[model samples]
Target: MKGIQSTGPALLMLAILILAPAFAEPAPNTIKIVCTTSVLMDPATYIGGDRVEAITIADPTLCPHLQGDIIPSRIQLNMDFIPGADLFMAYNDSNDQRYNIPAVNDFMKANNYGSVTWKTVSDPSREWNTPAKAKLLAEEVRGWLVQYDPINESYYDERYGEYVKSFDAIEPTPAEKEKLNQTQVIVMLWQREPVEEWLGMNVVNIFAPEFALNGTRTAAKVVDDINANPEKYRNVSFIIENMQSGELAKGIEESLKDKGINVKRVVFTNFPRSIEGVDTMAEVLEHNKQIVL
Candidate 1:
């Protein structure tokens, strides 16, 4: 009788414990990533697919590289947002968004918030914004996921392979040869050689601030860039303002216009987003293609 009584009670307890989880809500397995620059937003999404949720803090409408002192509003980016992430990455190349990095790293050190420590990782290389660079970003994202969630490596690899294949299939319009009305090149506040190659344009340049603040590029070394008398400087057809730095682009256009070079103007976003309904990394490139052509 005593054995039966004890055994029955134990069995009841095991049943309750086993059934408890079924009644309780299951935790979600999706990864959460926060990217500081708009440039990184689409790449994370393209590589992560359904497995990830990414938020970008930077704007596609303004310069991502604004000096902290020059832009007071940007210093207020909420640090609290970093704690909820599975991964946090900020672009260190171009304007690199360096001012925001310290705040993120400090929050990580204090909270140890995510699975990985975010050091000052930057790509000064031209690959950061172009589709050609996206393949590399996808590979990196897969490696990070596999390292942290080994069970999902196959899943991650499968998706990434699909992503890379599409990039391989892309056929940008062939390089333009004639430099008739001064050839056109995409301007990035500076040269983005990759974007130039992607657009098949002949030249690209970034605006030096001395022109904006001091009222002209004539005193600036950019003077040589405008002097088409030299063959190397001839093909700069227009100014394609980086999304973040359109103000700079407008100012540069005016400055250049003042100097007799009438450059065509277009705006380019650094990443994919809601604009023109573009939601995919590949679509982002396609959007640029449409814009450049």
Candidate 2:
């Protein structure tokens, strides 16, 4: 009888232990933030740490303007996080106002959810792919996190410093810069900032979508330019393409190949998850750098 009683209590305690995790609630004061994209979500997560739950609307690969049907579907999928989201974050760019914000607003209104705070973390017009811009972005995220949760200001500051250090760690060495300066590249307009400005590569030319510059700078046009003046781009060893912008360089590659000019084509992405195992902005920088190096 004594053994039975002792074992019964032990078994009951074991059951409780097993079930505890399933029933546990999130820590008190853990604010939930819903961001427009991974660019914003990544920093919010790093700075906020355990004090905030950050979720994003679009996959890192898809830009806000191209989200189309993805917007409503993502809102529905993240309904659990939406209801309790304390803040709605975005870059306040035209795309967010046109696509992400309107769709999110409609969902909340239709569902009769209460208003959530909205914050624009950075200027949307600035290119954020470069290390300098990424550091600025991390600082902005830390500022917002401290404002949102003053109790954890010290923790947020520490995380922000660590995030900045990651960018510093990946900066190109002087020797790498010297080599990059000598390597000539033809790149996509969207990727030129990092390839030309950040990496210090000599960009011979740039190509963009048909809509950009009224089709004057399309890939077809680049092919024509290469054909018309082969010597101008003769030294170009790499053709860098933006993953989001589609394969605009295929025609360029073929044209160059036919002219007996061979160049390596490398695709770069501005967002995380666009490349497997690249989950943060710093990783994105290093990933793109390794491609050219």
Candidate 3:
């Protein structure tokens, strides 16, 4: 009975000390992770886990090109959500070089924050048009994820490997393969970049219009080509990216309607609003299945 004296108060005090760190909030200088788009944010969260907080500036539905000029407002917003962001993740590429990169760079420079360019981080090479390129990009993304959390390097590697596997899983069904063989889809992209090349390689019977943007000359050329060989290209479809070709879709849709040539559905590459957890390219493609090649 000598050992059973009252240690309850002392134990309670010790317990309080042990749980004090948990109860105390994180410091103002804690590391914060910011991404350019919600799509980019998804993978960041998966990789960062609880170690870092993630934030996105662009609305998932709005095109990054059209994010508008509210720099002061954005700065305030960033300050509020990510007071201690250590790094920024951007997804701007050569296609977006004209607008996205400048805007993101300006913002970071003005705010004096560190940033990692997605294009630089991903380092897309000439193989972007091949399945090998897709695998490479996936691996690059995995590498970035692991860089932030070295402890979970193996986990990130496995996740990215799964992503690559899923992308390769997209084999055309018999009907799709038949369509692929018979139909010569001309992917009229709004932007002239590796995306068209990538699509052309994977979709096989696909071709890109001479011009990537929607203009009177390009539109007329497309119409002329179709008219010249209507019998051969009747089943042909057009795929447009929402980011750059939103206006093109309207123009082409109208132009085709006026000429009585009913083009197939106009698929948007990126959505009109911000959607959470759309990390992988496969996920982006699957999300827009209605416009799949």
Candidate 4:
């Protein structure tokens, strides 16, 4: 997966100069952005408005873990799009060990073109619990949104402040707070490494199929929790970092059903893309709220 380094700064400057007019006219304001997956691309699109030019690498339904064959068309697309990109976003973490990230990283390094940033959508602190990890990852995304769209800093700060206040308001009502806490979820991750931190250093709730497909005691506990009371826990969620097909999702659903528990809500959080949009952080937060709530 080795990649050649990008054209040096002089060539990059030359390329930028050549592309500057194209951008200055009407399209440059629309920053070209590339995402590793569609889950990330969609939300970015909502926030970017018309200013971003985005490209997604992994389709929503493909398994990123198994994406070994890099299409020539995609490579050519990246060559064409990345040179003109204002920002490049990628999910670089231990969990992506299965993907061809080295090649991707090499390409970005060689280009030295855009403001590249890495996002670990999964919580690295926690082991395998999906609910707590998803919440943490959501918070991380808020920060990324702020960084990506700094023009709306004040608005994003205010909206985030209000969101926190709303969460606090619910705390005063014990019954309501309990209800929020009872919103149990189960995340079926594509891998277990990246989310270790999000699950907390001490917490360990996942079981890899390679080691023991059925899961360990910690995972069993979560399964028990879901089985203990499914009615009370209406919102069960899972964040699949690695790309998975609809059939895999169905398999997870059926597995839960076998335990007399069914998943109520599901959200896809990762994807691939080419363009970058320019929207406020507030907008991104609002979109996340809609997906989760």
Write the residue-wise lDDT of candidate 2 on 1-293 in tens digits.
99999999999999999999988985568879999888888898887888888888886776667788888999889998898888788877777889888888888888899655678855779878999998888888788887878877889999899988999999999999999999999999989999988999999999988877898999989888988999998888999998876787998988888888879899889987677899999999999999999
- Order by TM-score, highest first: 2, 1, 3, 4
TM-score between candidate 2 and the true structure: 0.88
**Local error of candidate 2 at residue 252 (angstroms):** 0.5
lDDT of 4 by residue, 120-196 (tens): 55544343223333334335545666787787656555544553343333222455334434444444443443223
Reference-based TM-score of each model = 0.67, 0.88, 0.64, 0.44
Over the full model, what C-alpha lDDT does candidate 1 score relative to the true structure? Answer: 0.60
Tell me the spans in candidate 2 whose CA falls farther than 4 Å from its real position: 1-27
Kindly list the per-residue Cα lDDT of model 1 for residues 10-46, writing each as its tens digit.
9999999999988897755778777766556665666
Q: What is the C-alpha local distance difference test score of candidate 2?
A: 0.87
- Off-target runs (Cα >4 Å) in candidate 1 are 1-28, 67-81, 94-97, 107-116, 119-126, 174-183, 189-191, 204-206, 211-237, 249-263, 274-276
Misplaced by over 4 Å in model 3 are 3-31, 68-75, 81-83, 95-98, 108-119, 122-134, 165-175, 190-217, 227-232, 237-244, 250-262, 271-280, 290-293
User: Backbone clashes in each candidate structure, one number apiece?
Assistant: 6, 0, 5, 42
Off by over 4 Å in 4: 1-28, 71-73, 95-100, 108-149, 152-293
Model 3 quality (TM-score): 0.64
Pitting candidate 1 against candidate 4, the one with the higher TM-score is 1
lDDT of 3 by residue, 1-293 (tens): 44555677778889999999988975434337666665556555554445557777665655555556643356557765543565666655543465544655666667776554443445522323234555665566566666755766776666666656766765446665454454334444432233344333222122233443344446556556555655544444553444433444344445445566565645545431333554555555555442454
Instruction: Write out the backbone clash pairs for model 1.
Output: 62-244, 63-244, 183-237, 189-206, 189-207, 190-206
Model 4 / residue 37 / CA error / Å: 1.7
Best by TM-score: 2
lDDT of model 2 at residue 278? 93
Summing lDDT over every window of 10 consecutive residues in candidate 4, give the lowest-scoring window.
198-207
lDDT of each: 0.60, 0.87, 0.52, 0.46
